[model samples]
Target: MIIFLRRKMSRSKECLMKYNSKKALLVTGERKLKNTSEKLFSELKVSPFYLNQLSEVLPFLSRENVDIIIFGSDTYQTQKETFSELLQTVSLNYPQSESIILARENDVPFVVSVLKFGSTHYIKYPVGIKELQSLMKSAMATQPAISPRLEKEPGKDSSRFGLIMGKSTKMQQVYAQMRHAAMTDIPVLLIGETGTGKDLAAQTIHQQSERSAQEYLPVNLGSLPNELVASELFGHEKGSFTGATHQHIGVFERATEGTVFLDEIDSVDEKVQISLLRLLEQKKFNRLGGKKTIKTDARIIAASNENLEELLRKGQFRQDLYYRLDVFRITMPPLREKIEDIPMLIEDFLTRFNKLFNKKVKKLDPECLEVLQAYNWPGNVRELKNIIQRAVLLAEGDRLYIHNLPPRLQKTRRSAHSISFRIGTPLDQIEKEVIKETLALTHNNRTQAAKLLGITRRALYNKLNKHKLK
Candidate 1:
């Protein structure tokens, strides 16, 4: 029996070497806890690669075979220092490794801050051995075994990631156009109203394209001064201008091998536009006050709230440049056209703010949502996000009622309420009136009204007939 037990233990050790040799690296200052962790892993039939400190483990990390890294509090604790430098080092070095941190309950706020810096999971220390094993198993099961910064699915319809959210047919059409634009390397022109997320659309294209691994640089052409526009885009050598203190790399140079998003491209002067056209055609440009021509390989993506074709016709923009950028165009639908997305947008904003402010804002009142749907969102998604953020910040309870909304939205709600009532209205007549109001509110769409009323189209028609109203 003793010989058999010894053979079984040897076989178990051999299996561990074959299957669990890709050991987890644990960094901790406490020797006693390190031993405890090792013992726990032994009971779980796993092996750990322990290091006394992060600096000591850095050498091992330089090797590609190290599977996972676990950072303990001793390595991350610093009073006067931010973790930015540490995160940059990790990102520049590993870029793909999964990093887990053992934190304290009180470190939740600090953990959240470091999350943006690249650290993955943060679990409270003194964790049960079972829980630790479960976490390890789950982490290993994940493809790539690393957390991704962007949540968007690769190769999905680009419009679905376009920062505009809706499931309506109109939105689907817009999404289709966005996907087609993303498939090519052509310069895309996005035309839409102010706050309509033209910039968002450009970013979605950048994220979805083959150039996704490269940098995505956004420049607001309308905000740059006319005199400085050329230098800003094409870089400047020393003494290029009186204020050009030293040699500078421009947006084009920084965005080489990547994408450069030009917002309000039509606002650029004709001379600037001509230089831009030359760069697009030749893929090369000279520095300001310099004779040497530098080559760039950046993809161009332009957007404008105003109509560039109209600008070209009115002699305000260069027609050649406009045509070059308009090879693939996407026009985003206004919020008023897809008001059905307002409720979803509102919920998304509220959930985001709830996490941001650590509040418990649960729901937006139905009346508040109705009011939001009725308003013509001239400022579009940007305005809606701002309003919801402000409301969430001011809300004192779980529910966001109409009174907590902006004054404009509140006034719209009052107007809607005033129009919804009538004197001496019968029960059946009131039902019909309510149905008609809902239908009109939904742009006279029967399908949408029926969904809103929680009834089928046939049932809604029956109600209309029973009320003896057309």
Candidate 2:
């Protein structure tokens, strides 16, 4: 009993020691920023130190160990040269410590410039606590030094990687991560909203990997029936079920020593997840109705349009399976986040569709481009491609015009009058005004007004009589 007590105490001490080892330093003079840093560091359970001036940073850092350094953009803007010097010093003297900058969204160009000086990452200003917490945690966990930072060579194009195209800083960051994932054989998880080029990213990772020589198979799990997902992933023996008249070979078996890209992995049911977990853990799985465990050397790259972490929290996804695939995770930025790359993307799409359709569309009208740029792309690059394809087919001359675009995109500005009411406006009064406007728009047609108001003609007549509109 005494021995057990001593061993438990020793284990607790070791755990405490490990937790205390991670330290962060914040160099800022702003009070709000200092308060935010305190709250963030406290939540992360990381020891933090602060300094008001840049001069004390190196001296303090040299005396103590710090794992993260965050420079305030407010102060960093004034002392750009000094900040650059400090970044160099940190990179050369403390390569293990990652540096981050807190800047506004408009400062992307400046952030991109500083990234070349060995800075690890940047966080946009006015970030919510939850969003900032996630970013800092990911930054703390990653080793940016080992991640490949691919730059444009003198003769090579840097705007594109494999089939993925973009020159924005966000896409460049993604490209670096893709290169990092390609260098290893570990399972990778690609997370993003739909139409974010996740499929392209998966194919790129495989093409850049050593498994390029082998076959690359892509499976859209969402498109398959839930009952057959396991069978499709792991081959079934003859006479295993009613449909199994002959032996079947699955992606894992056929893609041996290659790459298997699993799209919409979140749709996989719990039964299939169990088999996936086992395959990831042991690199082997049993075929349906077969007793033998077959070994596979294929690399797994899973992607999802939904947030798998959220699914795990809701108990919809298996925790073990999520972690198994999250060993190396890459997030593809939404089209809205990388809007700067849209013009280039538009050009590429136009070129492709022009040749295929045998059109001579040379350029987009300035007004049309403006409409496209101003609109929020919910469907992302895929949506833009579809729009361009349609426009090319409709365009009659050498240049595409605003009229050729979809009605949703053709309207550069909305002319509809916005109705505003005071906080104390009576509900009846507001309803009267809405009804009046509806009747005016319908040119005094009571039936049309009733339909527009989502009410029957009798109710409209009663209201009109009560309000004396008749």
Candidate 3:
């Protein structure tokens, strides 16, 4: 009897708890897909409630014991906001249950965004039983996996961005978004602070995209003259204007069947925005003094440091154009938001400069790397890249040291490396001093420093105000 019971006990440990098929809720209306979804849930032995719209699921969610709620992102075309709102609602109402989005393999951006929004998992289509079983098991766990952000999936490669190297979760999400943008002809709007590698990301999209065989042109809308913006974008016929000595093809035209990167797109004037909007809608434009319509097949990948949505509300941007481009937007995180990626980025830049400047200097000092991590890079990746390159080219030593860094960075090392305290020091005083040191190390970046100090930003702010450091 004891031996027979041991065998049964071992079998139970290997198998997942069987869930009723009716306990599942799927938000899909497509009959074919719904059939497939139903079959998968049946195989997993989980009952599901099928709802067409996201709205139907909300009311049902309050009463039903939904183990897993699955939806297709195709339901939301340009209404990403509504989709997000639905996810938020589900998260609030049913925080314990798992939300799975049934997505296409090419919907990499969509997957990344939703995963960041606290989705537990996703079912990629032509869905298979094995994958579904795995997802089911994860969902049915006593403690469900929540938030797919900075996913450090085992055996997953997060170093595909080449010189923009990263194993960090933030970079992995960026890579996924970039990969998805590259596969489609969709116009991508990159939102991030300056020096966040928006230009690099634009270039990556163009390079990895289907149009890579053609020309890749970059235009800085912020630098273009108001009077000449039209000519620069759409070209001009010979003698069309004072400087139009010969027929010229503009950046948009030059990038036929390719990509045109409009950097600092927020800086575009209302006049240019109108032209851009028309071109995006019609894919056709006329050169100055030319009546003939010239159609372009160029793909657009616009980048900006400012919030385009905010500008749209201010009536500085067109709403229709914003929706078309914004649905597939990719926002790059600031340096402070993903400080874990700094070390790999530093190594990459260091190696590249070593080869470029014909130097053999290697092994960045540990202390030097710590200071680099602590200091908030206002200029983002570009600033760090430039700093590393300079240090690598100028260093006489075989390995990089603190002295190799810039004066501002070097000064930070002193305040960051040590914190003095008395044996009789009060707890509040010690806390204040540590906060000050951390802030100094992070160069007044409250967010990163607060994280380093293991306290909330509000807590750090209150301490700063108390110590009169603000």
Ranking by lDDT: 2, 3, 1
Q: Distance from true position, residue 150, model 3, in Å?
A: 18
Order of quality (TM-score):
3, 2, 1
| Candidates' C-alpha lDDT | 0.70, 0.77, 0.73
Those runs of model 2 whose alpha carbons end farther than 4 Å from true positions after fitting are 1-152, 412-470
Residue pairs whose backbone atoms clash in candidate 2: none
Query: What TM-score against the true fold does each predicted structure earn?
Result: 0.58, 0.60, 0.64
Q: Candidates 1 and 3: which is better by lDDT?
A: 3
Model 3, span 1-470: residue lDDT tens = 00000000111211223322236787776888787777787777777677888767766765665667777656655567788777765553344456777667676466557665543566677667677667766555532322222122334454756335666667767776665566467789999999888888888877765577799899888897877878889888999989789998888888878899989888777777778888998999888788899899999998889988789889988787777677568888888888878877877777788889998887888888888888777898888988998898789978999888999888767744787787999998888788877776777888888778777779878888888887
lDDT of 1 by residue, 1-470 (tens): 00000000111223323433455677788876677678766775555787875566555655534445677776767631434455544533343344666777776567656655432555677676676666665544431322132222323432345566776656766664555455457788888898888888888878866678899999998898988888889989999789988998888998888999999887898889999999999999988988998899999999888877678889999877878888877888787766667777777888899999999998888788877776667798899999989989999999888888888777765454534556777777778778877766665656556767888779988987887646
Clashes of 1: 0
Per-residue CA lDDT of candidate 2, range 214-263, in tens? 98999999999988988899989999988899999999999999999999
Query: Against the correct fold, how does model 3 do in TM-score?
Result: 0.64
Model 1: per-residue Cα lDDT at residue 329: 78
For model 3, give the 10-residue run with minimal summed lDDT. Answer: 1-10
